[model samples]
Target: MASNSYCESCSEEGKPIAAIRFCSDCEERLCKEKNRNDNINESEKLESAVYEEVKNWKNHIIKQINTVVEKLEIDLSNCKKKNLDQVRKDNAKISELYDSVKEKEQELKFLKEHGSNNQLYLKLRKQRKGIKDVVKRVSEMTMSYKRTLLKFEKKAEIDLNSMGSIFEVKEACDIQYKPVKLQQAQVQLVRVESLLTLKKVKTNQLNLSDRLCLSDIAVTADNTLCLCNYDYGVCEIYVYRTYLDDLTYSSTLHLPSEPYGISILTGTDKAVVTLPHKSYVQFINTEHLKLDKTIRVGEGWYGITTTGDYIVVSNTKEIRILKKMGEILGTLQ
Candidate 1:
């Protein structure tokens, strides 16, 4: 709403006019038809509207920027918290590492200071040598004492015979003299018999043959022996009957490599022979002197043993267990 200007011509206030322009030269406000600055006034109003709209837009943009800044601040706070937590974890790990290093350093210092107790080490070594020397000296002294005892017995017997039976005083003395002679005879006979028996025992020991040496040993349910010649590369497996002390030779299944291990399968004539390389287990038909089936396995098989229902084989890396029919059961790495 706009108020009417003062009418200079009529000098009255009753006449109202629409918004128009002011005339400075005429000293009056005029309507659109009479005013020359009407266009200018309209232009000014349009410029004011544009300025107001621009101010509102600037305020909206500033509000949006503030919102974005606030969100960024919250995100920065969360990141700072995460960084602090990570730093705490890293610090804890560093502290543990430092403690470990400190312990190692302390060990090194102890080793540098007193790793070898010189006096104690010297004392122990001296004591050990002294003990060995004392043992040797004691052994020599014991042998010398035994020799002295033997010589004493021989000398005492000769002296007793020289000093006896000449002095007959009374009947009672004579009776005691016979008993004394009897006792001396018993002691001399016992000494001579003991010495003779000891000599014969030592002679027998020297005559016994010492040629028997263990060729091969096997431990199983039935203790089976396989004396394979390692130097000759011969495949002859000699099963020695321990109960009867007899050997049964089988040149049937020629083992490709030297027998690494031997295992007797229960309730079967089959025996598993492991070789140097991946030589499959050669089954020797014990009943007939013939080569039986050979159970296959992986390469580089070294050791072969048997558990309940499973034949376990060991290679460089793993133990491959298989069934009796050559199916791979499992592996233990």
Candidate 2:
């Protein structure tokens, strides 16, 4: 004998139909008609829910995009205003220099043409020297201003590209859910102690003819230390193998200029050393212990660092960004 299961939804009806199938998700036995109606209703509910969620998400994204765009607009506007203000100030300075030079020229002409005293002639010579100095300073200032303008343009271009990427990402945003498999994290435990013991292992002395005036040092992956000796009489780079206990002198290479700062290039067997007074950085091959090439940076290159395909050197007044071959990209004051 087969026992019939009545539909859960319409069981109280006079003529309750027999349940033909069981829904695992709903945990109910339903008749054909009732099951069909429930499925249609469930699909409609799911569709409505999905539509509402997507609408909310879209609105949220729109709000975020608007906020970011507004911020970018404000930042760009501020930058423009600041650059314009600087340009105005520079122009005023240029005008002032022009006027001063013109006045000095008029004064010199008058003194040279009409004055007869030796003192007046000496004064004219001094005025001419002062005018030359002013002109040189003006030329330097103009170059600096041009560099600043170029930097601003580059920055603006980068910002615009970033904004475009953001918009592209927003447009490509699609709602998707995926099942992710998670693995247990592996953690290692290390022993900790309250007091640490320290002991002196070994010490080795460096024997050199010249005075020890070490300016910069760089260590290789193989425990080889390269030291720059900035002594005027003996400008040399010394390489030493750092053993477990002591250092052994490996090799020494002489440099033409005094090395001020040194930095190892990433993923390379080379180091860049800056010569402050000489206005150049020498690229030395650490493995071969020889000078590879030299790049003229600028005067007073005290600090140096390498990033990607560029080398950044710091002079006293400004930081100059250069390519590996010594092409000056930009300057930061």
lDDT of each: 0.55, 0.74
Worst 10 residues of 2 by lDDT: 178-187
Tens-place lDDT digits, model 1, residues 34-129: 343555786699778777876787688679869967987787777678767766766675576556556655655665577777654564565566
Query: Model 1 off-target regions past 4 Å?
Result: 1-216, 219-224, 244-253
* Per-residue accuracy of model 2 over 91-157 as CA lDDT, tens digit each: 8988988898888778767877888778577887788778778979878996786644423233453
Candidate 2: C-alpha RMSD to true structure equals 20.3
Number of the top TM-score candidate: 2
TM-score of each: 0.31, 0.40
Using lDDT as the measure, the top candidate is 2
C-alpha lDDT of candidate 1 relative to the true structure: 0.55
